[model samples]
Target: MWRRRAAVGVPLQEGKRVLSLLDDDGRGSHLFLLNVAQAGEAGLVGTVLAVEAAAHGHGDAPRFECKVSFDRRGTGWRQSSTFGVRSTNLSGGLPADGFAFVAPNPPPAAASVTITLFDISSGEPGSALRPVLPRSRRSRTRLSATTTAAAAVLLR
Candidate 1:
């Protein structure tokens, strides 16, 4: 039994959220995946964590919903995801690999994806990724995810 919860178009303030997803036995064996498609000055710091649970074999639990409530502040909550994780579909556990949508990259194993969303507000699409580039390279107009995606980076 695979489990995934998707809360689409949800707004999130500038801060952190710790979601405790565990089975009835209080065990966890899931991975975290994030995607951002927002405008303006926005950034996210997400940490996928796992603590010692009572057991580690409940990886195939049924659909479970994690409900959390918090008081909204003034503003700055951007439209975010109803994050979905493939607990049942992926069999053993999450894969430690990147997504390949087309030819440059192969098709995705699962229907999950991670993208580096940079603010193209600066006009140059890659401007957000390389905020501190030298004056000698400001005339170039290219859009490679702007580098530092490091090994996970795909230059499409």
Candidate 2:
């Protein structure tokens, strides 16, 4: 039961803003910042924030996957990247400007994860952004969970 605050608005540039995720204790995992361009072209232009996980090699660390989408008046570009398990407490930068999205990998079974857009200049979070988890991915997770449960039962 991780408690997280709603997305906060951060100004990036004219007609553009970012949203950031904060936790109840003013801490958050998987923080993201979006940079929207003036020509309506947006991109992710931030770095990955520190989010302490349960423990390393205990299967408690959180997984993350980020995707960016660009819409240029009909033509669009989409790119995605998934964070590896070995990637922990690491800092990385995103593109300077673009429309992008970030999500928790292995999406929570029942809990909701927050994705925020933050402005680098103002140092504040902006509106909330919802990036849907693909149905196929969700199903795969369910299957894996069921399989793991069955295996544990057998071992017992």
Winner by TM-score: 2
- State the local distance difference test value for candidate 1: 0.26
Q: What TM-score would you give candidate 1 relative to the actual structure?
A: 0.20
What C-alpha lDDT values do all the predictions have? 0.26, 0.27
Tens-digit lDDT track for model 1 on 4-113?
22122222323322222223122332222332222333222232222222223335232221112221234432222222122223234533432212111221222222
Worst 10 residues of 2 by lDDT: 147-156
TM, every model: 0.20, 0.25
Spell out the clash pairs found in candidate 1: 2-88, 7-82
Provide C-alpha RMSD values for all models, in order. Answer: 19.1, 16.5
